[model samples]
Target: MPKPKIELHVHLEGTVRPALLADIAVGNGMAPPAPSPGRFADLHDFIVTWNATTGCLRTPTDYRIALLAYAEEAAGHGAVHIEPIVDAEPRLGLDGWADVLAACVDAAAEARERYGVSVGLTPQVFRGQDVGYAEEAARIAVRFAGRGVVGFGLSGAEGRHPTLPYARAVALARDGGLPFVPHAGEAAGPEAVREVLAMGAARIRHGVRAVDDPDLVTELVERGIVLDVCPTSNLRLRVADPGRPHPLTLLHHAGVRCSVSTDDPALFDITLSDEYAVAAGLGVDAASAYAAGLAGMLGTDTDRARLVRIGRAAFGGIDVGPAS
Candidate 1:
């Protein structure tokens, strides 16, 4: 059996199977974007493709189908727990955000029963939009906290919008006991990571660029903030060079906690296991990778304990040390 794992930084819309997207588009009397070379030309290209694909989801039923499909996919890859980011900008409308989130919660409950994979929803605000949108999304996330929504996140064009604008929204999430996890240090740089940190982010998604500043890396280590790093996404987005050593290895060796994830498995054409394989190739052993996953999960205590038991069984009771 494959070793059990936890995935903390995948996106629900990004997990829509290509065939499903085509099916949805055809049924809705819409034209599906033509298939392109699997790799993205740039971040803008990626965002465009991502938006087009997500646009196919028009109802709560559509969201549930996508959620359940992603659950099964992650479970097949040995993910015992997953936190899939859901962008709040509605394909249906602003009111439809509630329906989408409700569907996700229902699908997650069913997924746990069927696949034994615990699911958490992390609703994200598109940074390119106004901060009020973020505040709205954050309030929705806060309302659903512990129901299925486990955290709040900020995603999208990082360079186009600075993190400070969303501070109040992030603060609302923090005050409501939701883990604040925002995307940073990918399209931008280490300073972007710093901005999110100032907003009290418990974890950072794709914070691979923190390695650029030794001081920032040291601060990350000191804070025990986990980074959910997606290696293939970094390469596909051209944020990191494929030929060079990935920042994940450097961050791991520097004592910064890190977890391997497939940010968008379907979109990026990779898997959670594939990410672990890449990490292994870069000299990070399976035990260390699993250890990081355990430490980085945003699940509750019961869920964490379940993952710990699963990990202990799969890795032959190996000493999975503290993340730091």
Candidate 2:
């Protein structure tokens, strides 16, 4: 087996291959979404495609299939752990969330038994939503913390919606023993990253723009917040500067804990192994990020120890240092 690594950022809906989504849509008696282009025009285009595709998931079986397929592919990428962010669909009542969570939990158990892969589901609240829905997302996340949901994710257009409006939701999740891992510094600048940090973000999704601010970078180093960086996603969405090397290189060099990931593997057509290779080619220590992420996951100590042992057995000496 290849060196066991961890993918700390991915989207549950976006992980489903377009072809598979078409199949599910047909099975659900709905028309499939239009075939996506080679790359999206922008985040808005991506979200439109996302909603059209994921809207077909009407049953628990669809959710199970999505997660298991992702786990199978991730395992082939030498991934022993994956944290896939699931959108908190406002239409889903608490009952609907429970069914989806139940399906995911079963799929996670099967993945562990079948592929030796551990799965953590992170429920995401969109920044574009009102406080009521965001707070409900937090409540649902808290309600299912240990069963399968391991983290709380804040997503949506951070540039348009400031974190202040969603502070209470984040705080509720954090107080309920769920780690806050919000999307920041992608659609916005370093100031957006600071807002999430102020909300007690344990890990940030695509915080590459923090490199634009030296003080913010230093604060990240001092506070030990991991930025789950996805190079392909950044490049595809035009979030990273095309003229410069990927920011994970600079962030790692500056002592910011950055874990390479596939934000939306199927949508980006990138794998976790490919992402690690990209980071390594740019002189980032992906192995260290894996170690840190494994140690920092909300899983129990026993699970962390087992994952570390599996990684060390493959790659040898995965350093779990300050990155955790």
Candidate 3:
């Protein structure tokens, strides 16, 4: 049997393969956006590239296809659970985002029925983007609470924007019964992580830089906060020194709760399986990483228990359960 795996921080727009994007682009009678370069100079560079890559998506059907495609491919590679972030504003307004979420929810249902991959959608608010839109997304996510939306997140060039302005947005999401899981500690340093932690984030994406402050790391360990680490994405974005093992390895070794992810798998040319291997090579083994991923999921106890059962068989009898 294949190793059981869970993805904690993958973006929905970043999952569409070039071929899939081209197909959608051609179907819509528009030329596909230029291919993305393999490596980005920085997070700012990556964001610009990421936006260009999402130009192919113009309708809800395109979102449905992208969601289903990633679910199918990821499930084939042993991803038992995947939470995809969908946050493309301007290109999509609140109404369109709701449509995309509905389409993704229906598409996730199909993935569950056919591929058996448990997928939940996450709505993200860009840091410093309109607070009104951010609050609206939170309010909107409430309607899809158990249906498909599982988590709420903040994404942007963390260096350019502060997390303080979005506190209300995070509070709104939490009030709507969604977990606040935002991207931090990648483009910025430990302070960025602290800001989100203060906002009651359930888990953090790309929090490798928390290692810079040893005391902060201890606090994370004490709080059992899970930093969803993406080694490939980090190195590609230059957040992690390529010559060294990723910072999450240090955080993990120091007892910080760490989980593996592919922050933007297709955009980074990686899979959940590949990320697990990368972390393993950095001294974070698949079993522990997968276990942390499971523990960090936003699913209900009953949903998590069901996944634990699947994980046991998927990992060929390795057990990690009793999700709290």
- Whose TM-score is greatest here? 3
| TM-score: model 3 vs. ground truth | 0.95
TM-score-based ranking: 3, 1, 2
The per-residue C-alpha lDDT of model 3 at residue 5 equals 79
Q: Quote each prediction's TM-score.
A: 0.95, 0.94, 0.95
Q: Write the per-residue lDDT of candidate 3 for residues 1-324, one digit (tens) a residue.
A: 567678888888888988988999999899888887869999999988887888678889999999889888888878888888888476778898788888988998998888888887887889868888788877887789888889899989887877788888788888988889999998999999998998888999988899899999999999989888888888999999978767977988998767788887878887778888888898888777777888788866766887788767656545466643
RMSD of each: 2.0, 2.0, 1.7
Candidate 3 residues lying further than 4 Å off, grouped into runs, are 314-319
lDDT of 1 by residue, 66-185 (tens): 899989988998888899998888455667887888889999999999999999889888776667767877787788888888898988787876678888888888788788889999
Best lDDT among the predictions, by candidate number: 3
Ranking by lDDT: 3, 1, 2
Local distance difference test, each candidate: 0.83, 0.81, 0.84
1-324 per-residue lDDT for model 2 (tens digits): 566778888888888888898999999899987765637767767777777767778777888999999999999988888888887786666578767777888898898898888888888888778788889778877887787778898899877766788889988988988989899999889999988887888888889999999999999899888888888788778887669977887898999888878888877777788888887787776577686576556665666777767766665756753221
Cα deviation at 27, candidate 3, in Å, is 2.4
Per-candidate clashes, comma-separated: 0, 0, 0
Cα RMSD, model 1: 2.0
